[model samples]
Target: EFRDMKTEEPEVAPSPEKDKFEIIGKSTSRIDGEKIVTGRAPYTHDIKLRGMLYGKILRSPHACAEVISMDISQVQSLPGVKAAIQLKKGRVTYAGEQVAAVAAVDEKTAEQALKLIKVEYKSLPFAVTEEKAMEEGAPQVRKRPNVQKFNEYTRGNIDKGFKEADFVLENTYKTAVEIHHPAETHGSVAKWEGERLTVWDSTQAIFGVRDGLARALKIPASRIKVIKHYMGGGFGSKLGINDYTVAAAMLAKQANKPVKIILSRRENSLCVGNRPSSLQTIKGGVKKDGTLTALYLKNYTSGGIGRGDYCSEPVVDLYKCPNVQVEEHSVFTNTGASRPTRAPGHVQGTFALEGFLEELANKINLDPLELRKKNYSTKNQGDKETPYSSKGLNKCYQLGAEKIGWKRRNKRPGEGNGKVRRGLGVASQIWWGVGRAGTQADVKLHPDGSVEAICGTQDIGCGTRTYMATITAETLGLRPKDVTVKIGNTEYPWCGGSGGSTTTPSVAPAIRDAALKAADYLKKMAAENLEVKADDIIIGNRKFSN
Candidate 1:
């Protein structure tokens, strides 16, 4: 029998100074702290079941090649090799594209089987660099030239704005591609019980995997249930279902036994998503007094065999520039598709726009901080029509400057004589502070007066579980220890998968509001039992009293 968490008394002191006596903002230790520290967290690969097959994939070796022929006969004929598949006649568009896969009784056998499967390739001319592809005579990565999408945006008359400007500055900035190496490599353990499919995947969205499995296998959604109790990390790479997830499910169905497919570190790096490299140019005109007159930005980037766009997101809205023109272009390369990284496009934009602003400020003989302050807009300049929920950029700038002693910064570069250079650079930023849609939270107050907060969201080192506990405890007038947080289950209510730094602001309020509603119901019930109005009673000393 399971013990109810509510009945157990917490081993801590109780306080009742505030109207709502509970812990919210106080930095309570994470409930999963001990488990994580002790290496007791049950990750996806830790799962073990009866008679599970190991899966290994065969990959292409050429950057751009056509698979002319594949010989998997030796691999299939090998002992303990349960299944093997190859897509040879079809083009292997990328290096390390999964050509085939094998399931064997053991990892060693599965790996050996992969090597036995040989493939032939017809090499094709490849273009990796964006600049080379855009040249007059470069091999076409796709049917079109090295232009994925060339989009232009304008707010006002650019010629008029440039005419009004006393000065203009333009420069190009480049950023390199970054890989998403989640602590846990991408993998999935699929168990098929007759027609029913169950997948234990290392992923951010369980339902997304389920949907993919359902569609790929031509099975109903009800037949599939994907569970991801805990993930090492995804960084947006695991936001949707991946090819490996589908492969594992298919292998399990074919083998008539559970199959676990976990890629090696090398495989993860090759197949998993990565942030596309970017090259951006910003041209801004500014007045002598440090006011931005006009800004024009052009970005060139590659999504690597997929579509990508840079909306000039940071430049088009960051400052109070009236005349703005933004253009973006994304080209395809013979690499993996670009996945959304943290603050996608914004980080690149910040580096370019901020760096340019610093240069422009130097030209105008104005402090960078003061220049940004002069261009600060209480409203978002991107949409121009839509206002923000709240903007603390100006306040953050002032408070940060004062705390960091902005006045001490040397106005002239190369003035510092010390071995170590002391420099202060300030950049202004704003995030669209809204969470994803279709979120549901359930807060329950047991008869023994403990709280349980349930939601279908994962805590990827972001203190989401603890935040939910705080919200629940705050509403019920209870301490952190009195609340049990439950999450990362498809069985629970729906919630947007965590991304875009929207989890905290978006879901925290929903959890708090749900907890409050539950608490109000409980309060009314308790007051009726005590023969007093709900307003007459006060929450104190972890109990309802007069």
Candidate 2:
């Protein structure tokens, strides 16, 4: 339901007054602050269901192996083990790939049951590094070639632009693989009532989990409810329906009781996700006056069995280069698949691009800040000739430069000959922020003068509840504390999972739209009560008057 937020909204002309938000800019304590600090907030890890059995997954010890034979007979007959089932068959691609799962009276029993299950495997030669994977005779991780060129983008003539440049620079920048796990490891609690299922999960996407469970359990999505009122943090680790969650659901059905599966910290690090390593080589051409003539990026990244990020967006869209080209390849390795880590490709791309630009500026004896200002374009060069509706990047650059005392910096890079030195640097990033289309939310105003703003978007330890309440309250001329924000349950109106910097933009406007509609209804009621025209009525200070 969160993904189906598509409603064609006509563009609204920009308004300066409408853009200035008083309530939004102010600082306020989080609405859930007290509950969290007091240890009363119920996260998925803290949930305890009646008759709930603890579950644990058995994983392959080998990085690359083919299953010769599987035996879970001993685990099933083990005392206190409620249910045991195999999750994977045939070839295991990564080291921590799920092989089987066991549910028992407690986590210890479940772990012991897993140890009793025996599986035979034929270990296969595998490469786990990007460099080794790209080698000529390295072991193949997949059917396809280890190094596969999956993406390419080009605009204008590459050769012509390079020839037009006064100076050209080429260098290779490498970024190592980065793995960051959330404070709360991936987990789920599943309970079954007749044919219906309810899941308490620590996930970024609730509807995504519901749909995934439907696909996995062979049940209708309508019969499944996924709830995540709070999360420690996602960092892009928890996005869709994880296998452990499905295992819990299946175990619950088999054991005729609730099942809870929480991943260990080791499992979280091994299977959840990581930011893939990148070996990016950039060849850039620039004119004497800091004009970017051409830009070319060739990147090879590895995410184990996962798709690597397209680490060329910064080169293609960041500047006003006439000729730009990108060649991105994924070098498959035998390790945990990569997931979106924060900005994913952008962080790595920006580091490489920004560093290259600084070096490029040094070559031309131009200030890097001035070089950025000189090439600022209101039109997006990467997209199909679309002009930006609004861009405040240049203002940000000016303010940041001024605040950092840019004039006091050394004229050359690492030029000062002193034991201790202070330096200033500047960089910029393009963030694509907007509400996901079709995101729906509801505002309920009870006869008792209470308000509730409901959406399916989960707050991943961010102050989503506070802001939702603030938006609704401000719209209805009430205090932020007066309105209650309810979210993290699929039972609420549809909203997509909270990630890609979309939660606030997507959920806030939807709630605001509903709040505005409620305000309209209130104004109509007040006008009829006072025998005045609806348009003449005004709303402020929690009152409607003519």
Candidate 3:
């Protein structure tokens, strides 16, 4: 069953019935553009403290192994070794699993100290592919014996729908493992002050990091504050504090000094998260007229020894059909854990679904665009069953087709070729993030007339700072330059992390409301000065007079 997580509804402000907008919807320069260009922005790695020491981890060499013994005696006597820890108990699950760590005055010393440590392991049989892991007697990756579990989803009568179909198509598709190699490798600088822990982390979700650190350290959430004003990237990898962050905290506590740890590029490759590879089997039927009859799909995916579902989502209702069946399953393998990428499962699903549908269209002698338009659902068939708040999908498809002259596309592949083959493909997709719950914004107008808008969300190169300033300036009858937007701090009010495609629909209205409220306050002040009703005085370009 499709379910949407609860999200906040943006408050709509009453129109002031005025126009001549100065900023809203117009392109504007980013507030942090100068800092970015000049390399003046302070990222987490830029933090340096007086007693800070660098940290490095010694990782396992084998893909799958049992840690039999760990010796850190040589590492302890290294030139600048301050602290070291051996893997206390658990089995080494994957290559690069930290067997030990060392803190030193410098990275060179840290590197030397790490090499001094010794670890002996008992290697275990392993399977890298999802299919291999599923074999009857294949080496078990997870403690669970089997590699697959069924998560069947159904709607309507599939057997009858298949019976009515004139043609049926079945195919399997595969995607490769993808990494979220954000430019900024995962790093954390932890400094303890009595009971409080301050962390400078490179992460997408600072608030989530704070909570994760607090929980991992057995400290109250209030005692942990994570600061990450400028992050290189996440795609989705940096959503929360990883074990490395926690390890930095633990090492700092043991060393009794500030500790900084950044995963080396090699370690980052194995430890950082990625989009898991998936195998999907699609069985679909269509009529001679290009109408869909039944759609059945099954998905199996591996997240590198980690467990999570990676299904062909939105499959339950991507297109309209009388009968549909979907089963999503996940299994563990000796690979990196999966994390959300740009569109997560939807991008992969669309690639397979759209590609298959194009083939189906060819077999049925129908235009691909026309074929998709025929199956558009009036309501969200995949989930809440709610009518769309608004749908421009048909218009989008039509406009795109017209602009691209899709009618001229080679109907058959290999029809036009010399050295380069020319084949045109069309794909349709939908993302359903209206917004998330609990976002607050505060707008204030300075005595000198400049306005400030504050929300706890990062820009992440999405132009959030510019858009917010524009929204505020437009509402207050001012220019974008007259407004300021502050963000990327947990100290500010709660706002969703800037990951999903919901930022505009989520934050824009709040900015407008805040600007309107600030204007109302100014109007009240102006009414007293102009000897007229508050509503009679209109706010305009740096002036509050009626």
Best-fitting candidate, measured by TM-score? 2
In the order shown, what is each candidate's alpha-carbon RMSD?
5.1, 2.8, 4.1
Q: Rate residue 520 of model 3 by lDDT.
A: 71
lDDT of 1 by residue, 1-546 (tens): 111122342221233356544566466888778887898987888878799999888887876888878888898789998878763466665676788888899999999998998888889887666776667777777767667556777888777888889899989999888788988988889999989998888887777777788888899988887777677888988888887778777788788888899988988877778787788888889888988888988888877766554637788888888899988888777777788887787878888899999999888888898899888776677537567677888889889989999899889655778788878878866556576665777787676766788886777677888888876777667776678888777776667667778777766766766766665566687799999998676664577876
Give lDDT tens digits, candidate 3, residues 1-546: 001112433333375544656555456778778988799988877889998999987877777888888788888787778888764455777777777788899888998998888777899988777877788788887788636665777887888888888888888888878888878788899899888888888877778888888888898988887777787777888877688788888888888889999887777778788787778888888898888888888888777776544455657666777788888778677776777778877877777788789888888878888888888876777433778777888899888888888888887755875888776677888676776666677787676766788877776667778888887777778777777778777776667766767767667766666667677777887898889999788877767766
Q: Which stretches of candidate 2 lie over 4 Å from their true place?
A: 1-22, 382-384, 418-421
- lDDT ranking from best candidate downward: 2, 1, 3
**For each candidate, what is the lDDT?**
0.78, 0.86, 0.77
- Model 3 misplacement above 4 A: 1-20, 382-384, 417-419, 446-450
Q: Write the candidate numbers in order of decreasing TM-score.
A: 2, 3, 1
Q: Flag the better candidate by lDDT, 1 or 2.
A: 2
Better-scoring candidate (TM-score), 1 or 3: 3
What's each prediction's TM-score? 0.91, 0.95, 0.92
Clashing pairs in 1: none
Clashing pairs in 3: 304-335, 305-333
In model 1, how large is the Cα lDDT of residue 403?
A: 98
- The count of residue-pair clashes in candidate 3 stands at 2
Over 1-546, each residue of candidate 2 has an lDDT whose tens digit, in order, gives: 111122543332232265555476688888889999999999999999888899999999998999988889998888899999989889998999999999999988999999998899999998888888888999999988998898899999999989999999998999988887788889999999999999999999999999999999898999999999778888888888898999999999999899999999999989989998888999999999999888999999888888888788788887888899899999999999999888889988998999999999999999999988877877786544788998888999988888889999889988787788777888878766577887888888888998888888899877899999988877778888898888998888888877889898888777777777777678788989999998788676787877
